[model samples]
Structures are given as structure tokens and as C-alpha cells.
Target: MSLLFLAAVNVSPEAMAQGANDEVVREAQPSQSVQNVLREEHALFSDRLTIEPGISYSYSDRSNLALSGFLALDAIFLGNINVDTVESHTTTFDLSTRYGITNRLEVELMIPYVYRSSQYETIGAGASTGGLVEESVSQGDLGDISAGIYYRLLPEAEVRPDVVWNFSVRAPTGKHPYDIRTNSRIVDDGEGGFENLTVPTSLPTGNGVWGVSSGLSFLKTVDPAIIFANIGYTHNIKRSFDDIGSSEEDVPGEVNLGDSIRLGFGTAFALNERFSLSMSFTHQHAFETKVTTDGGPEQTVIGSSANAASVNFGATYGLSDTTSIVTSVGIGLTDDAPDLTLDFRIPFQI
Candidate 1:
């Protein structure tokens, strides 16, 4: 599983400071346009006692070939020799709320629902038998619940950029993967033979362990354009599972999934009073996973590390003083990343 994090906007001291951080540099008269600029405050943070409700949808597709340890080398040359071809699709819907406790502090809460579908089929293992096996599975469940707080570290200024600090924690409120039961069946190989196979299974909605993340965000005002950068890290706490294996055979142990480092930079251009465009590049590196087997020594899982990167384009359009719509499309730049992702969000302040 993977996570996409959102970094909020910078908080300034006064109307002039906010203007300097977003729009003043582009206009000839700063005071005369204060009201027009203030109306776009949703682009950054909400005012005190304001509550904002938002929803976002995301989709990703990924595919890979599974190879046996012994035939791993041969499978490279003979692609069809691989055991199975796996394809997966994931859809996530997040309902979230944000409220401002003060001008420089904000709190947020989010709940997500996830749906996943997967398919696996034997390739050339039994080509003469019209392929050995075909399986499909689908599942949906509630995802992790998360809460966060953002604090302004530095107010916007002409010489220095606006900076904010964020901390968040996620609870394991969703169904755990280890608790899911595995299913298998015997299928025809098309060559008058039957083969026993462990069919493809749907994935869980959340990791069973608790997670905490912290990050720093900074944004610089450049008249018609605003440039922002963020860096963060997430650490998952170790958790014991009753059964970690898929088959009937059980492997109970303590699992430490991985710690990830994330970084991104983006720029948004004000197309007009009601619309804006943005582009960003993001990267995340997850360390190798570690596991301890029934009080045994800890061991690293091979090929558990991941390096993912993506380029994203976004647009924001304001419908009114307190409502806005945002949308983004992301394309993976590395093999470990999802092939493509599309997201849409609508935020309304009350």
C-alpha cells in the first residue's frame, strides 16, 4: 500500500502580509485589491472559527509479473515462464474536515473508504492447456482514520518565505490484511488435467500498525506565481500479527513495514481571480521492511524497498467566496509508482 499526503498553505500575520505572500507583488495598488485577494483565502488556510468540508477521489492501476526464485533468471529471457501475471486497481474516497483554531493554527480530520480489485492468471506455464489458471477478487472497506495539526512557523515577508510545520497520526481502524482468509480451488488446465492453485486475493484497506508523520512546508510569493516546497517522513510502529501468511500455513510475527521519506516542490500560477494552475514533482523512498519471527532475530524482507516518483498537474477554480473546486492528474515517473492517478476535491467553508 502507498499514501499520498497533503500540505496546507502558509499563514501570515495581517492582510498586508497575506497580500505580500500571494498577490500584492503582482499589482500596482496593494490596498485597493485587499478584498479581492482575501476572497481567495481558501487557497491557503481558513479563518478562525471557520469549518471546511472537503472530499477527494483517487484512482491507481498497477501490474507486475511474479517469478519463482529458481526460475527468476530464466523468466527474464522467457517472459511467459513466469508463474502469474498480476493486475490491480485501487480506488479511494476521502471525506475530510478542517477547522481553524486560531489565525496561525489549524486542525484536520479525515476518513477514507477504499475499494480494490485484482486479477491473476497463469501465462506460459500451461499454454497447451489453454492457460493453467484464472482468478479475480474484489473487496471494499473503511480505511485508516487520521488527524493532524498545522502551525505557522514563520510569517510571510518580502525577504523570507512563509513556513509551516505539520504533524499527523493515523489509526488502524480498517480491516487488517492478516485477518483475511485465503481461498483456493482446483481448475482445469485445458489439457485434460487439473491444477491446484491459490487464487488471487483482494488487498486490505489499511496497515494494521499505527503511523506518525511530520513535515515542513514553505511557500514563496512571486507576483502571479507562488512556489512551494515540502519534505516529510513517516514511521510505522511495529505490530504483532496472529497469521501473516496467505496459505493455511501461518507465520505469526512482529512486522515493521517501512519508514518513508517524502519530498515535493510545486508552483501555482494565478490565471485570473477565479482560477489557478499548478505543476509539481514528488518523490518518496520507503526503506526495506523488517520482521521478527516468533522472538527470533529480525530479518529484512528482500525487494521490500520502494522508490516512487510522479509529476502532477492541478487546477483550482473558485465558485464563490467560500467554495472552490480542485482537480489534479498525476503520471508515474518510475516503475515502482502507480501508472497514473486522477484526483478531484471540493472544499466548502461554513
Candidate 2:
């Protein structure tokens, strides 16, 4: 965390007791104030180095029910009902290094390791007894690595806020969702037929495509409070894979992932010199994804576009002049977002 000091004026007691003819000399003193601790966590210090290690965890669960068959006489309906439920948990550990190339520019690189687990359950699907089937998968691997550059477009002033522009590129170095084999079992249907139920054998650790993002952030300080906002867009490069199909046969195809737009704003209050609290809201909207199979015409994937929104609360504590601890909790506000997320980071300046 960063610290700011306010200048104070002190007058001699003797001078204050003297008459109007006596001139009192005042001395300026410095006192601690909380100002930029939240917005400027990674502020660029000329020719300085900073290393941050962080861990984050997220959990989400979704359930869906589908019915097939027609209604009889608009009264009692006859249908084949199926219920699908999935629960997922993810954890990531990452290390980030930032170097200041100049007073106005800095660069950063981050590498992460991810572990994921998911459970899938189906009820009343191809079963005469309405039995429940469940499967679980877990995987751990390296996540996508990214590098970014930050430029201070406008320095903070008494009448204006600090403005920064950043650009980043992400590499697809982790396990992707595509081309993973699935485990299947044959189940008997109530109508004397059999159906194959399948589930993934492993979870994906990355999106599999390269991505580029650009964003601008604004920060302003007002006495004991700091305000910040940011907006960004991400573009995912189109990539091809040897097998994008779900069937047993190999079907090569190209996948064009949906681009996304992100927006966030927050405010922080300094409780004291070493501690601060923050609250923020963030939202991301993703476009629809498209795919081309076997060089065929591109087809859009329905329901692939989604909006995710979350509210977050954060705290930062300065342990020393060169080190700080930052922690945050996020609660999902939309169906597309995770149910809850927690993050912890410790940054050391050298």
C-alpha cells in the first residue's frame, strides 16, 4: 500500500501569547493520511521493481431441467423429463512482476497455476427407475500466462485525476476445453431403449485461444477517500483444433471465441495509515461465439453470449514500507458469474 502525508502548521506557544506587535513563526509538520492506497497499489516508481504473489478461489453451480414430449388434452402432460446439475470449483496461484521502465511507463508479467474440480449429475435421464447418475473430474495444470504494459497518460493534479492506459497479451499455455475425451455409460430408457450418458474426464484450465486486451483506468483522491474506474475490451484470436467435435470420430474445426467488454468502478476509504477498505462493482459482457467445422460455413452457438456481474469488497494492510497485504471477496450478481470468489495478494517492492 502507498501512503500520503498531510502538511500541518505549528506555532510557538510564546508567540501566540505575545501581543499583535510580535510576529509568530509557524513550522510545517507532516502527518500520515490515507489517499492512494487503494487506487495506486501498483503505482509506477521510476526504476523500481515489485513482485506480487496471489491466490484466488471461485465456486459456481448450475442446474437445468428439460422436457421432451407433447401434452395430452391440454391437461396432464406426457414427457420425458431430464435434470442436469453441475458444480464447479477453481483455484489459482499466480506470481506477477512489475518493472518501471520510466516515470510514465511500466511493464508487468504474470504466470499462474490453476486447479479445477467439477461434479455433474443427471436424474431421470434414460432411466426406467428415475435413477441418478453422477461423475466427478479434477485437474491441475499451468494457466495462461500474460504480459502487459502500463503508461501514465496523465499525471494526477489538484484539479485532475490520474489516467492510465494499459495493453496486455495472453498466451494459451494451459489445458483447453476442446478435444478432451469423455467417459460414457449406456443406460436403459423407460421405453425399452438405451441411451449413452457421457461426462468430461478432465476440466479445462484455460480458454485455449490467444487474447489481447486494452483498457484505461482513472483514479482521483479526495481527502480520506479515493475513487477509481476502468473500462476495457478483449479480443480472442480465432484458433483451429484437430478435434472440436463431441462424437467418437475426429472433426477438425476452427473456433472464434466471443470478445468481451469490461467495466468497473470503485471507491476506497482509508481507516488509518496502514489499513484501507474498498467497495466495487464490475460487469462483463461477451459476444456470441462462432465455429466452422470441416471448413464449412460458420455457425453461431446459441446462448454462448452472456453477461456477468459481481460486487466486491477489498481491504489492504501495509506491513512495512515495502510490503503490503491485499485481500478481497466478490459475490456474483448474475447467473453467468461465479457464486463467490476470494482473492489474496502480497506485494513486495524492491
Candidate 3:
């Protein structure tokens, strides 16, 4: 998950030091372009209550191959080989609300609903007797709910950038992955024997653990463009589950999900008062996960650590005085990342 920080516009040093005899320094009013960019960066601060509704879609496909026998003479002999592929689609709708308690302090809350579909395919699973076996599963449920607070440490100035610190907590309010059960389907082989294939009956909507994150963001405005950067860390609490095994036997265990570190930087260019364009790069690295079964020692899950990177492009258009449309597209740059993601949001201030 990406951590977003809040920001606010500030008066320049010159404006604050101006003498009474000199021309009056009128209060700074952000143009539509500036507003759009600030909102995309989550830097725009408002004293009035604001509500934002957003929707996002992401797609991912992964493939794996396994060989049961080794080749003879390095080329000629081969045994059973199986190929497994998984394609997943996820859609989420969320509502976020923000309120500024003071000029430098703000609070926010977000609630999300998620729907997911997945297709699993296996080829050559039952030696040479089986062709292709496929299974599909879909589920919809509530997602994790989160709340956070933001504080502006330093306001933007001619020689300084705006600095904001943020902290957030997430609750495990969605479906638990460990609680979902897997079912097996038997298919007849060429020799009249049956082969069993197991697949999950449902999908999880959340990580099933409490999460806490903290970060700092900085933003600077230079004429027609705004530059921003942020870095954050997330920690997941370990939790115990009644059944974490895939087989029919009950296996109670404790799962400790890996923590993650994320970094992002971007710049937004304002073409006009009502439209703007922005591009950014983000990367996250997750540590290895650990699990322990009842009366068993803790073990690290191999190949569980991952690095995900993506490039994102975004645009914002002003619709009315109190509303604006924000849209973004993300392209994956690594195997662990989603192939593509699209996000749309609309913010309304009361």
C-alpha cells in the first residue's frame, strides 16, 4: 500500500516581511491547476469537510512450470511437466472523508468494498493422461478500513518546501484467507482412474491482520509545476488462525506477514487552470513471511519476499467550484507487480 500525506499552501517570506508602505500582499489563492495537482498528491488541505468517492481496478497474471523428471543426454529425455497459470481481477469502491482540525492538522477515514475474480489453469497435471484443467472463483466482501491523521511540519516558502508527517492504522475487517476452505474435484483419467485437483472456494478481501504505517511527504511549487516525494514503512501484526492448512485436516497456526517499505516521487504540470497532468514512479519491497504451526517451530516461507515497481500517470479536471475528477493509470515494471491498474476518483467539498 502507498502512503499519502497532506499539505497546505503557505505565504512566502517576502509576503510576510513586506512593509506597510509597500504594496499590500494579497492573500494567495491557488489556481485550478494548482488545486488539481495538490489534490492528486494528497497535499491539498481544506478547513471545510470534504468527501471523496473512488473506484479502482487491477489485473494480474502469473505462470509457473514444474518438471518431475530430469533430461537425459542434456536434451532428449524428458518426463512429466506441468504448467500452472493464474489470472486475477480485482475491483474496489471506496469512500474517504477528510476534515481539518486546525491550519496544520487534519484527520481522515476511508472505507472500501472489494470484488474479486480469479481463474486457475493447470496443463499436463496428471502425467500425459490429463490435458487442461481450469477452475474459476469469484467473491465480494468488505475490505479493510483505515483511519489516519496528518500534520504539516513546515509550510512551503520561496526557499523551502512543504513537509507533512502522517500516521495511519488499518483494521482487519474483511474476509480472512485462512478461514476459506479448499475443495477437490475428481476427473477421470484415460485408464479409468480418477485424479483429484484442489481449488479454493472463496477469496480473501484483506490481509487478516492489523497494520500500522507512518510516513513523511514533501512538496514544492515552482511556477507551472509542482514536485513531490514521499517515503513510508508498514508493519503487520502476527495473528493466529484456526485453520491455515489447505487440506481437509485442521491445522491451527500463527502467520506473521512481512513488513514493507515504499518510496515514491512525482511531478505535476499544470496546462491550464482547470486541467493538469502528472507522472510518478513508486516502488515497494516486502520482507519474508514467517509461520508457525501448533507445537511446531517457526519457519520462514521461501520466495515470499517481493519487490514491486510501477510507473503511474494521472490527470485531474475541475468540474465545479467544489468538485473535481481525478484519474490515473499504473503500469507494472516488475514481475511481482500488477500488469495494469486504473483508478478514478471524485472529490466534493461541503
Among all candidates shown, the one with the greatest lDDT: 3
Q: Estimate each model's TM-score.
A: 0.80, 0.85, 0.90
Instruction: Give candidate 3 misplaced runs (Cα > 4 Å).
Output: 1-25, 194-196
Candidate 2 C-alpha lDDT tens digits along 15-106: 23444775754532111123224224325543758888999999999988877788999986587777888999999999989888987888
Clashes of each: 0, 0, 0
| lDDT, residue 161, candidate 3 | 81
lDDT of 3 by residue, 31-87 (tens): 665676665575566788889999999999998887788889989657887788899
Give all candidate RMSDs, comma-separated. 6.5, 6.2, 3.7
Per TM-score, the best of the predicted structures is: 3
Number of clashes found in candidate 1: 0
Off by over 4 Å in 1: 1-43, 48-80, 125-132, 184-187, 190-197
Candidate 2 — which residues are off by over 4 angstroms?
1-46, 69-78, 125-130, 188-193
Q: How close is candidate 2 to the true structure, as a TM-score?
A: 0.85
